[model samples]
Target: QSIMMGGLIKKGSNNVESKIPLLGDIPGVGWLFKYGKKSNAKTELLVMITPYVIESDDVLAQYIKKFQEKTQGLRQGLGVKGSTAALSGKTDKPVPPGE
Candidate 1:
């Protein structure tokens, strides 16, 4: 089976302000004499992903074993049981009440 996923991420915004030199800086009457302009620019990111599912347990196990062997050097402190749990789609932490 093949699964397709897509997402949009908005990163940042831009703001701009404009004012007359002498009139804009006035405290109370700044609105009438001076003008302030603000504009916002945002960055949009698109993420597309496709994942192929392994149907057979033996194939899945082989892939998991290969992954474990590759990552063994990097995962010195973490336990093998935790990795196995994640591979089996089992989380050690209990789910929250609402979620």
Candidate 2:
């Protein structure tokens, strides 16, 4: 997200810039422009405000249900202690003891 946000700043301005976000108000991370007449002049700003968000739904909603069903069926059909336990502990295999 840093790369994305930083790219926005690069495209927006060519003045002094800071790599950090939300710290644009800090000393040198960004620029502060001033213009006007007389001693007590007015100040202007072109601060960069970044936006971000979390996007997590397609992977979960799209495949989670299929993964659960396939895993459960493999356990029950094999009857190797099912999925709830270890297959090595199953005492019902047709082979003789250690054979």
Candidate 3:
């Protein structure tokens, strides 16, 4: 099975400026007396996930073993002596209520 997700983000900004009406029109000093600003932004994100189906417990066990081997190699390459959970910022400790 597979899942697909997509998103779009849009952002905008507007600025209004004021200066001495007549003096701001002067050619050389106009820039120093007058100001205006505007901005526009957009972003897009796409994510896709595919899952494998295990036929039985044996197959699932084999898959787990292979996944562990790959992750172990990755950890070694990154010189991480800690568990994967540490990298993921997860711990087995229970959280207290309202904390």
lDDT of 1: 0.62
Q: What RMSD, rounded to one decimal, does every model reach? A: 9.1, 23.1, 8.9
Give the clashing residue pairs of candidate 1, or none: none
Tens digits of per-residue lDDT for model 3, 1-99: 779866566666667777779889999888788877766666666687779987997786677667767888988898766443332335576544422
What's model 2's overall lDDT? 0.45
Give the TM-score (vs. native) of candidate 3. 0.37
lDDT of 3: 0.69
| Per-residue lDDT of candidate 2, residues 1-99 (tens digit) | 233323222223234333445544567634443222323334344445544452676554445456557767886687644332222344464544322
The 10-residue segment of model 3 with minimum total lDDT is 82-91
Q: What pairs collide in candidate 3?
A: none
Q: What TM-score, computed on C-alpha atoms, does each candidate reach?
A: 0.32, 0.24, 0.37
TM-score of 2: 0.24
Candidate 3, residue 96: Cα displacement in angstroms equals 16
User: What's the lDDT for residue 28 in model 3?
Assistant: 88
Ranking by TM-score: 3, 1, 2
Compared with the true structure, all predictions reach lDDT values of 0.62, 0.45, 0.69
